[model samples]
Structures are given as C-alpha cells and as structure tokens.
Target: MQRSYSPSVRRRRLSAQLRRYREQRKLTAAKAGAALGWPQQKISKIESGEQKRLPAAELDKLLDLYEVSGEVEREALHECARLAKERGWWSKYKSAFPGGLPDFEAEASAIRTYEAQVVPGLLQTPDYAAEVFRAYRLLPEGEIAKLVEARMARQGILNKVDPPDFVAVIDEAALLRKVGSAEVMRTQLRHLKHMASRHNVDLHVLPFAAGAHAATSGSFTLMEFPDPLDASLAYVDTPTSTLYLEEEEEVREFASMMSRTQSDALSPIRSLSLIDKIIESSIEE
Candidate 1:
C-alpha cells in the first residue's frame, strides 16, 4: 500500500504477532528469555509495546526462535518494524499527550466515540475548545491555547482523502449544556451539522428520555484499524489520567457499551432534528 500507516500502529501489530507466535510455539517468556540470553522483562516489554523500538537483531532472534516460516512473512515483519520507528505529524505535540491518542488515530480505519458532558474533541470548534480548556483552569493561558491548537490539528483526520469512518454518539445533555457563549455554541452546532453532511461522518444523539444508562455517565472512544492483525483499542480520559485499553477482553467491554449507546441514540435524521431544535432554542443560539 502507498499509504503511510502510523508507525506506532505497526509497532503494536508487530508486537502482537510476536506474542502470538511465542504462544503458538509453546514457549514461556522465561524459556524464551533464557534461550535468547535476555531478561524475561525485556521480552515482556516488547510483547506489551512498552518498548519504544524493537531492534532488528532482537526481532530476528525472536523470529528464528519461533521458527517463523517463509521469506514473505519475515519481510513483512521487518517492514512493520521499520515503519514503527517513524513518527507522525502529532509527534511535536508530545507535551500534550506523549505517544497517545494521535498515534492511534493517525491510521485508524474507524473511530467510534461517545460523549456525555461536552462535544467530542474531534468535532469541537476552536472557540468552543478554548472554552472547554478554560473550564478546568488547570493549565496556564498559553497551555490552553496550545491545547486548542493541538485539538484542532487532531480533527484533520476527518478531512483525509481516505478518512476513518467517524461515528459519534452524543448525549442530549451535552447539546443542552452551555460551554461557551451563545455564539460559540451556535458555531459549534453548525459545524456538527456541516460535518454530518460528509459521507464518512456518522452522527447520532442519545436523548434524555433514554433514561439513565451505564455508558453515558462517562466518555470513551473505540478505534479500529484496517488490518485485522491490529486489535481494536479503547480510550478513556479522566481528570488525572488517560487509559488505552489494548486487550481484546477489555476492549470488548467498551465495544459492548458503545453498541448499547448506539442503539439508544436517535437516528441520523432525528439527531439532526434534535440538533436543530437545540440550535433554535434561546440558550444555544
């Protein structure tokens, strides 16, 4: 493929492949480490993607130990390892979220998001984003501006020629909530409608009538890559920390929540109608 896939994703996929091969070979981490003359922690980190980069020599050794077959498979792994070392545009924003959301988002084939209290970062307008940053009052003025800029940059994925299918299930509470002044919200809502017009953007609204639900209490994102070798990821952001769930069992739980949330949300047409109603209201306008 001509596309420049995110290096981080390749690294992750590579790590997963190695882990699978080790298990298939019936080799414990301890046995693998003993054979490779390395510490078990080293193999553990490599398999878990905690290692920043997988050196070529180490990868060769692991493949040989696993008795990996065929030149094509070997070359593919090497290629993935090579791509894994490169950085995406978001590399410069490491200060905001080091090796975080952007790394995964850069090459995602599908992005499923659910928001409760505010607009998803991908859809927030600049002024609206700034107001959101100011809400916490944790960062300095300069930091707020930087974060807004970083957030705006993140939205660029929606504009890509082969952009991920962006699906957002937003609670009605978020639409009614006042983040910034009327003008800022008006612009934000209008932007949402505009984005919804696009082919790849799928927007839905979960109404208050849906009653209390488990998923709506917080927010999360589920990202899926094009390659089946790459497992789905679940992202959760909190006041103090962020979590990236890579394990299939854990990601499945979030995936189930997203499925339930989608079922309760208003359909695309009805979602637009609700948005229009909100826009027509005195507060948002």
Candidate 2:
C-alpha cells in the first residue's frame, strides 16, 4: 500500500487551497471568519498550517461560502480530509520532528536547494548527519534514532526508478566547514562526488570569488512537482520557523534568483574538483 501522509502535509494542501479560494473570491480572512461565525485567529491558524484538523461540517460550510464549484475542487477537499486523518510513518516520531519540516521535504518532487553554511541533509553521510543532529540537542536517544532513520529514508527518493531531479548550489564556505573529523569530511566529499555523477543530480559550487550573490540573504529550497496542476513551492528555513511560499509570483522570483546563482557557480565537474581540494587540504592539516 502507498504510504499515508502526515497531518501537517494534509494541512498544507488544505491551507493552500483555502487561501486560493479566498483570494479568487476576493475575501479576506476576517471577512470569511465573520461570515462563518468563527474567530479570525482560527481562520489564520488554518491558513498557516498551525491548525491540525477542522470539523467536516465547518469545512463543507466554508467551501459553500467560498462558492467553490466542480467535482474536482470538491474532491480535493475530500482528499485533504482523508490525508489529515491518516497516520504517517513519521507520526510515530512526533517527539523528534519540530513542526512540518520533514513532511515538506518528503513531499517535494524536485528539490532545488542553495546552502551557505553546511551540506544539504539529503547529501549528508550517516556520521556527518549524526554530528549535525547532536548540535540540535533537543531529542532523546530513541527519538534521535527515529529522526535519523527518517532522514535516511528520504534519500531513497534519489535512487528511485524515476528519481526526482536535484539541483544544488552550495557555497564554498560550506565545503570548507569541518563539521566532523577530517576523515568524516573526506568521506562526505567523496560521497558528494559520487552523487554528482548521477544523471538526476546536478551539483554546483558558488566560489568565494562569486562575492555578493542573489542568495546572500539566506538559504532556500524550491520544490517542483510532476503534476502541472500543483503549484511549485519555495521553502526558507529559519531557526524558529520555516516559511513556505507558494504564491505564483513569489515562487517565480525565487526561481529566477536560483537560476542567477547557479550561473555564477562552478559546473558539476569543477565543483567536484573544488570539493576534493578542500578535503585534501583538511586532511593535510
């Protein structure tokens, strides 16, 4: 059977649809809440993916209020309900995952990521990943194991028969950072070298010489889906909360920025050489 989705995943889909419906009808959250006899805060919570569940009756009423039509739209809402109630494998490790970061990562079909500090999670080796997790210091041992396993499981997507295309633009600073021992760093770099050879993976490195780039603001990920009907998503991770941007114009802007950054970065072949040099230097030290 297909794996069930987590509640947060369901919430995100519902929230996006609800926001689109409201915008199409030119209704603000306050105005919609007023019409439904619900608090504005509740409406906002639902839209932000903070509210885990909603009453079926309330959802139906809201759909009617928004004047949503057609069987497809109606079926979308029903799917949201089913996904919301379904239990995902990750649900068992709720104590480890904060918010819905893992869920979002899992659902993404094509991930375009730019990292300024450290290697992206999907490319991390088990030892390097453990060190990174140790930095968090929020979860117990069992929970940490579960979290690590979930992260490793996500890598399976890269090896699937029809793997998602991955385009990563990593900063030179990231390669220079010694997260673990020199040995661990060497292994990780070698692993990256291997991944770069994969047809579905494209690795680029933004050299220090490429100063003052578009991604100087921070790291972000743009995820695209197979279905043309689904909107592309842009994710910005912060210390406290993660921002998920789905607005067509905003996502387009991020895509443009990423393209510019990638153009400035070294090609896959040169990126591997750079990483190798960094690893050798670290080993020499």
Candidate 3:
C-alpha cells in the first residue's frame, strides 16, 4: 500500500532533502540563491518549508542544480514536492482550524494524547463535537456545524490503510462530565470502547484515585512521525489559542509527562470497565 503522506510531513522531508543536497555541494543559501537568480531568504524559506508551495519547474531546477541523477531518487523528491504543495483535507474548511492540527494529525505515525475535561477530538462523536463547539461560544451556529464537520474529518486518519498508533489517557472527570445529552455521552463512551478494541488504539483512564498527576496542567497531544527525519511536535490547547511546540526539549518534556501520566492511569482493561460502569449509570438514570 502506498503510504499516505500529510502535507506537513512532505514539506519537512522536502526541505531536509534540499538542505542535504545544497550542503553536499558546499553551497551556502546565499550562493545557491545567487546561482538560481532568487533572493537569499527565499532559499532559507524553501529549506524551512515556509514557502509551502514549490513550483514543479523550480523543483526541477533545484534537482538539476543538486545533480540528482538517479531516476528513482529524483522521482521520490518530485513527489514529495508535489504533496507538500497540496492542501490537506481540512484546509478546505479554513475557518475551523486556524492552527493546522489536521496537518499534523494527517501524517503522524503515532499520537499520545491526554485530555482532562472532555473526549479527545479524534474520538469525539458528531453530536459531542457540536456541543463542544457550541460551548466554546467562539463560533456562530452556522460556523459551528462546519467546524464539527472538519473535526470529524480529522478522525479519518484512524481508519486509513496504515493508521497511526494512538494512545489516549483521559482523566476520570472526562468520563463523568456531560458533553451533549445523556444519549450523546453514552454513544461517545460506546465509541471509545469500540475504538479501544482497534489494534492501533490504546485507551486509558486516569482515575480520581490517581489524584494530582503529571498532566494536571491540561490537555495536550504529542505527535510522532514514521520518518525519523521529521521531528516530533507537541500541541497544547489553551482557552485562547493552541500552542504547537517543536523545540526538542519542550517536546521531550511533554512526551515524558505523557509517559508518567500513562503510568498512573488505569490499564486498558480496567479503563473499559470504568467506561462500562459509567455507561450503565447513564442508562439507569
């Protein structure tokens, strides 16, 4: 199966490869830009993947300059450049995701998520997602629907041919907290149980007994890519804005926090049981 690639990953890969080529030729960004008759900063941007879209003609010129002779290698990088330019599925609903979480999720090979208040976005049901949007009060009713659709679209990663390895550690409060209606919550719990059964997904619940854990700060997601060439990133969602942390130390700290929190959480089997109890209580009510 052809590995599905996200634009974000492709961009990073392309930039890294270009930098390697330039370095091998002993060319600085300025010298390279001079030779290509482009601004020096443009080279830096291209190397940083900030340019977003690299024209095929320009890519061809760069490949020629790099003396990339092997047909296989050339074609691979050409495809990378092409994918980097293509917008992710979520990009269509631009207003919904200003921070580009979808782009990161699209290419993530593994994701470790911790949620304190509600279901993680990837596992949330449509009704639950709508309620979340409504509660935020940031979007009008019309815009909320579009955002919900976009959020649902992000879940597609879990069902793709080669899905990411997803592990979620949720606080006990999230299970007890009501999102939409009782029915919506029930459906969400059931969905979580089903998702946990998937080989790629591991769901854990941090019980109330495990009070004041490492992640008391709030919810965050640590996304890791398959290619070691691409760096891991951590996303922290706050009330006002989402912070995407890429600095090596910060990402490592978040990763360590997730690991510690997971240690304090209920095992998958016990977490499922807790969910079942909650589901039963909801039914009795």
Candidate 4:
C-alpha cells in the first residue's frame, strides 16, 4: 500500500496548521515561545515547517493554549504528532545510501522534472540506475539491488488505470554523459526514445546553446495533483536530505522555472531526433 505521510509534507502541513491557529489567536512567536517555555527559534521552525517533531506534552499544551479545542482540530494535531514519530521504509536504507523522496513524488498526478546533470530516476533503465547507484560507493551489492528494485517499482504508477502525466526536461549534457558504457548508453537512449512516444509522456531537451537558463540551480521536480485545493509540491534532492516545497509562493516560483526551462527545450519529436543522434554516436563508438 502507498504511504500517506511524507516527512516533508507532514512537516509543511503541521507547520501551516500551527501558524494558522497562532495567528487566529494573535499570538506572536516570542509570546508563544515564552508561554510554552521553548525557544522562539523553535516556535519559528515549527511554524515554518522546518522542525520534524514536537514533544507530545508540548504539542498538547500548545493546542490548548491556542484555543484549538474542537474535536476535529485536536484529532488533526494528534495525527500530525503520530506521523512525526513514525518511521518510513526508506529509513532502513538510509544507512546504506541516502533515501529518495518517492513518497511525495508518487502522490503527484502530474510530474514535471528537469534534469540538468543526469537522467531522471523514474525514466532510468535498470542498468543505468545500477551505474548511478554504484557512484554512491556506500551501498553493498544486495543493498544496491534492493534500492534499484524499489526505484523500478515506482514506475508502475505510470501504467495504472489513471496514470500521471510526465513531462521531462533534460539538458544536452545529460545525454552526453555516457553513464555506463557505449552499449548501455545506447540502450538507455533507446528506452528514452520509446518513453517519449507515450501519450502521457512529454520529453524535451535543452540544447547546448541554450545556456544560462533558469534551471541552472540544479535539478528539481514540480508535482501537481488532481485535488483542486491541494497545493502542488516541488522536490529537491540533496546528498543528505530531500526537500519538499508546498507553500504557494515556492510552488509558483518552481512552476515559473519549469516554464522557462521548457520554453527553451526542444519539442518531443525533436527530442527524439536528438536521442537518436546520441544513440547513433554511441553505436559508432
């Protein structure tokens, strides 16, 4: 079964709710912190969704102080507290390799990914993904295989009854990286070409000449959902932790960044042509 709460998403939701209650009561962070016997910075972090957990007793006290006495409100806050303490499947793999942000990414009904450095994980082949995992140099053979299988499992969502639309924007450099070997790259490029033809998949390429674009800040994925009121999410993966941006302003900024990147990227047909050219080059090698 798919999990419901991602750490980042949970943090944002809890933070937003806390801020809302505090604002309704006209409580400043300093005042609230003083009342709760906590540091103002701690209150700020919780309000901003940067903190992961709050002590259960502290949370109960904050809710009571905020006058959030409704049964529904109390239940929601308790649920957040519960999620904060729960561990995810990825945690087990964290000791071997940094876990992916698949929990939130999977929840998206539409995914827009920009890869300036490498192939996006969802579209990668098993061989190519193996090579990418090897670069980490921290995972054992069994662990690497398990991780790759987990990644591959994520692809099943694309084939579901109502699959999410996927738009991938890749840079010219990613195609030229020659990830595995000549043969492996050739096969991976062929796989991408096939995926590009899917009705739900839109693949585009940012040519080498289209330099200094908005996405130079590295790779990111903007995920949209079917729920009209549910805010879209932006995902950024780092070596240690994955960040999820759910606030309206942050989501809008990432959306604009995607628009700029897609505007300069080649169309799906042209992207296929470029992939074909890369495949031919790999063959000649």
Clash count (model 3, backbone only)? 0
Cα deviation in Å at residue 231, candidate 4? 5.5
Error of 4 at 153 (Å): 4.5
Descending-lDDT candidate ranking: 3, 1, 2, 4
Best model number under lDDT: 3
- For model 4, residues 81-106, the per-residue Cα lDDT tens digits are 67866665556655433534655554
- Displacement of residue 226 (Cα, Å) in model 4 is 6.2
Task: Rate residue 119 of model 3 by lDDT.
Answer: 92
- Candidate ranking (TM-score, best to worst): 1, 3, 2, 4
CA deviation > 4 Å runs, candidate 1:
1-4, 283-285
Q: Model 4: which residue pairs collide? A: none
lDDT of 2 at 204: 99
My TM-score estimates for the predictions, one after another, are 0.94, 0.79, 0.90, 0.77
| lDDT string, candidate 2, 122-144, tens digits | 89888888777877776676666
User: What is candidate 3's local distance difference test score?
Assistant: 0.90
Which of candidates 1 and 4 reaches a greater TM-score? 1
Residue-level lDDT of model 1, residues 104-126, one tens digit each, is: 89889999999998999999999
TM-score of 3: 0.90
The alpha-carbon lDDT assigned to residue 63 of candidate 4 equals 91
Number of the top TM-score candidate: 1
- Give the runs in model 3 whose Cα sits over 4 Å from its true position: 1-4, 64-67
